[model samples]
Target chain A: MSEHNDTFFIGWSNDISAGLRRFLMRAAAFVVVGLCVVSALLALSITDPARSLFGANAAPDIPLDVTLRGVLSSEPYPFLLTVGDAARPAGHGVLLSGDGKHAAVIDRAALGGQVVEVKGLLLKRGALDMLVLSESPRVLQNIQPAAPAAPVPMGRWRVVGEICDGKCGAGIMSPGTGIAHKACASLCLIGGVPPVLVLTHPLEGRQFLMIADSQGRALDRGVLRFVGMRVAMEGEVERRGDVVLIKVDTGKLRRL
Target chain B: MSSYKAVTWNRNKLIYDAVAIAAVVLYIQVYRHFGAMAGRDGIAPDDATLSMKAFGSCAFVLLSGILSIGPLARLDRRFLPLLYNRRHLGVLTCTVAAGHVASVLSWYFAYSDLPPLRALLVADTSVAQLAGFAFVILGVGAFVILLVLAATSHDFWLAFLGPRVWKAIHMAVYGAYALVFGHIAFGALQDARSPALAIMCALSAATLVVLHLLAGRKGAVEDGQFAPTAATTPWVVACDIGEIREGRGFVVKLPDGEPVAIFRHEGRLSAVSNLCAHQNGPLGEGRLVDGCITCPWHGFQYRLEDGCSPPPFTERISTYRLMLDGGRVLLDPRPNPPGTRVSAVVIPQAHQTPVNETSAP
Candidate 1:
C-alpha cells in the first residue's frame, strides 16, 4: 500500500513540473514578442521622419520657367546656374555685358574652359516692340573659320551730301537753326553734308572701308553732323557720282 | 522569477548598437570635412560660411538616419530591437538639427543686416529663416516626447499607470516626425546639390507613404469596431477557445469600423483601442516589441498587460477582458472598475499535441 502511494506522488510531481515548463515557454514567447514591440517603438521614435513608415511624401512636380533680364555689364548675372552633373561652378552672362551700352554680358571668370551654351528669349524692360533672342551661344570653344591676311591696306576720307528728305540730320536742327553759313564751310571741308556723310581712304586701305557699311547700318536715323569738322577719316575710297563716296578705312580714321 | 529579467536581457545589444551608430556618424563627419577641403578654393571666400556648410552636411546625415529607421524596421524584423533606444536617437538627431540651425543664424547674423533673433525664427529674412523655425518646432516637439519617453522607460511607470493610458500620450511621436520631415525637405534638402542626397530624400519619403498605406489598409479591414460618435460605448471582446496564441496579437473589429488591438501575454490576451489615441494611428497593425505593442505610425509603446504607462510618464487607455468558446474569441466592451487586474487568455496550440482535439487546454 505504501509503495502504491509513493508511485502516485511521483506521477503528480512529474505532471506539475511539465506544467511549469510549458508556462515558462509561453512566458518566454510573450517576452520575445514584447521585446520586439519595444524595439520597434524605439526605432520609430528615433527615425520617424513623421510621414509614414516608408517616409513617403507629397512632392508633386512644380514648373520652373522664371527668367530675369538686366544690362550686360562687367557684373555677371546674380543668379547661379547649376552646371554639369556635378554642378561644377561656371560663369554666366552678366559680366560680359559691361562694355558701353550692351544689353547683356557673359562673365568669363567661372567659365572653367567648359563650353557654355546660352540660348533663349530674354524679355527687355518696358519695351514690347523688340525682343532679345540668342541662338545657342557657345563660349570658350575653339573652332577654325578662315586664314587671316598678313596686313590689309586701309585709308580715310570725308564726303558730303545734302539732307534732301526724311529724318536725316534731324538731330542737327534746333527749333529755327539751319546749318550756319560758317558751319557749312567747315563741314564741307571735312565731309559734312546736310543729310549724309561719307568716308574714304587711299586705295591701299581696304579693310577699313569694308567696315564702313557695318558702321553705316548702325546709323540709320542719326546724322553724322560732325562729318567734315576735322573728324578722323580712314578707309578705302569708293568714288560714285559727284558725291565722292569715300569708303573710309576704319584703321586710319582721324580728325584733320 | 522577476519580470525584470526579460526587460534587462537585451541591454548590452542596445548599448553596442548605439555605439556603432555614433562611430558611423563621426566617421561620416570626418570624411565630409575632407570633401569640403577639395572644394574649398572654388567655394565662396568666406571661411566661416564653408565651415557652416560642412557642419550642415553632418546634421543632414544624422537627420536622414533618424528618418530612415522607420522604413528600415519595416523592411526587416531584425531591426525590431531598435525601438527601445529610438528616443535617444531622437535627442541626438535633434541636437544635430539644432546645431545646423544655430550655425545658419550665426552666419546670417554676421553677414546680413537682420537681427539675430529675427533671423532665427522670422520668415521675413529669407526662405531659410522660415525653414529654420519649422525645424526648431519639430526639434522642440521631439525633445519633449523623448524626455518623457526616456524618463518613463522603466517598470515603475508600468506598475503605476497600468499600460493603457501611458501608451496614449507617447504616441505624439508621429506628429513630431511629420514636422521634422517637412523641415528637412524644405530647409536642408532643398539646397542639396548632390544626386545622392536627392535620391535618399525621395526614397525616405516614399517609404513613409508605403507604411502609411499598409497601416491604412489594416485600418480599413477593422473599420467595423469604433463608431464615429465621441461617446459611443467602448468595445469589448472575449477570447474564443483555441483562438489565442501565446505570442501573437490578433485584431478585433467593432461594429463601427474601429479595431481593438489585442495582445496575448502572460497566459491571457487583452485588448486596447486599436486606433492610436494620437492621430488615430492604427495600433492593431503595429508589432509587439519589448513587451510593448508599439504603434507603427509614431512608435508609442504599451506594456503587454494592464494597459498603463511604463514609468515617469502619465498616460492611459481603456482595457478589456477576454473569453473563449467554441474556437471563437469573445470580448466584453464594458469598462471594468479601476484597480482590478485580469490576465489575457492565451492558449498555446503547439502544446496541445493532439490531432483530433477541437479545444485548447
Candidate 2:
C-alpha cells in the first residue's frame, strides 16, 4: 500500500506526469486487447454448431413462398408427403406448422390419403423440414382408391435420444435445441409444433423420428421436462416415407 | 471530491470513459465477426442470439477488469490510474448486462405462448433439479445487483447515502460477481462444446483471488508494523521525524487498532485519521495537495491542521495531535474531534531542508 515515489496523482488535476501517462496508456491498450481476445474466445466456444438451426449458411429465413403437392395424413400429426419431380427424385416428408409456434390445423379424416396442395413458409434444418401453413390447404386432386399414406411399422424397441421441437430442430433459431433452448422447445411443443426424438446415434440410417404417444397421437405435454435432455424411451418405430415416426410409451420414458 | 452536483468530466475521466466505450465496441465487433465460425450446418446466428453472446461476454470481461482494479492498484502504484473513475466502467458493465437481458427477451421468450417476463421467470422451472436448475435466475439476480449499484454510483448517492452505507452496498458487487460466475458456469458451461469458456472463467477468477490475497497480505503486514509500543501511556512514540516522507502521510496504529497518519509537508508535521472520509480509502498512502492531505484512493483532500476538506467541501476526518519529542515523533493515541484545529509541529532548523520541489502543492 506504500509507494515511495515522486509521482503524486491528483485525478482532478489536468496535468499528468509523463511517466505515469505512458504507463496508463500502455496498460489501457493491453487490457483492451486482452478483453477482445476473451470475448472472441467465449463467443467461439459457447455457441455450438450442432445445436444451431442455421449453421454454415444452412438456411436463412425462407424468402420465396413454397407450395408442395402431397398426400396428407392426420393420425399422429398433420404432415405432407410430397411426390418427387424431375429436378428432385427424393421427395420430403415435411411437418406442417401454423403461425407462431403452433402446428398447422388440417382436418385429419378429410385430408387423409387425399392428394392435396399445401403452401407455407418453409423452415429447414438438417433432416428436419417444416412448412408453416400460410393458409388452409386445398385438395388438388382426389383420385378414387387414394394412395394410402401408409406407415410401415418397424417393430417395437428401446431407443435413446433427445426430444426437441421439430420447428426449432429444423432451424428457426440459430441454436434451436439443447438445454439452453429447453424452455423454448417446451413452448413450441405446447403450441402443437410436433416434437421429434433426435437419436443420440443414427439408427439404421435414421437420425430422428416424429414423436407420438403409444396410441400414435401427438406426444404428452408432461414429457416437456425431458426435452433437450438425453432420455431413453421404449417405442414402436415406423418408417413413414422418408421420415421415421416413433410411437413412444410415455410410461417407459426415463432420463439417462 | 468537489461539489458533485454537476459531475466534473475531467480530461482523465473523459479519456477513461472513451477508452472503455471503445473497448466495448471492439469486443462486440470482434465477437460478431471473428468469434463465430461456420460449422458444417447453418447460417450466421440471428441478431438476437448474437446480441446475447456479444453483450453478455462483453459485460463479463468488463466486470472482471472492474473487480481486478482495486487489488491491482494496491499491488502496484502504477495501476492506480485504472482505479480512477472506475465507477464509469461499472456503469458500462451494467448497461451491457441490460443489453444481454433485452436481447434474451426479444428472442428466447418473445415467441413463447406465455408473456415474455412470465416465460423468463417460469421458462425453465427445473429449480428443484440440480442438472437443469434455473440459471437465468442467477443472471437476473446479478443484473439487479448491478442495476442498483450503477444507479447509485454518482457522488450524490455517496453523499446522501453516507460513505459507510454506500460502501456496504457497493461491496455487494462481490456477491454479484459470484452470482454471475454461477450463472455462466451452470448456463453456458453446460451447453458449450469448447473448454475455452471454462478455462477463461477459471483464469479470470483465479487471477482475482490471487490479487486479493496478495493485496490483503501486504496491508496486514503494514498494519502489523505500526502497532504502538506503550500500552500504559496515552502517548506513544510514533516514529523518527526523518522517517516521515516530505508531503506524505506516515501511518501509526494505536493500541486500540485505530490508525493515525502523521503527515510532513513544508517542514511541519500534522496528523489525521489514516482512513479517508470518502470510501475509507488509505489516506496514508497519499501526499499533500495544496497543503491538504489528498487521499490516494479518490483525491479527497483534508487540511493537515484541521481535518476539514478545504472550504466549500464540507467533508471532515478526525485529526490527531503530533509532537516533536527530541526528533522522535510522539503521537497522542486519543484522537481530536473531527475538524478540530491542532497546530502543526515545525521541524528543527537542522531538519528543515526541503526535499524535492518537483511535485505540486
lDDT of 2 by residue, B228-345 (tens): 5544366788988877778777777887888788888778999899888877888888877777788877788898889999878888889887776776888887888899999999
Candidate 1 lDDT tens digits, B321-340: 66554355566665443223
Identify the runs in model 1 with alpha carbons over 4 angstroms from their true place.
A1-256, B1-10, B13-17, B20-28, B44-47, B71-75, B111-115, B121-194, B215-240, B256-319, B323-325, B342-361
lDDT of 1 at B343: 74
Candidate 2 lDDT at A161 equals 80
| Chain B TM-score for all candidates, comma-separated | 0.58, 0.92
Best by TM-score: 2
In angstroms, the error of model 2 at B309 is 1.0
Q: What is the Cα-based TM-score of model 2?
A: 0.89
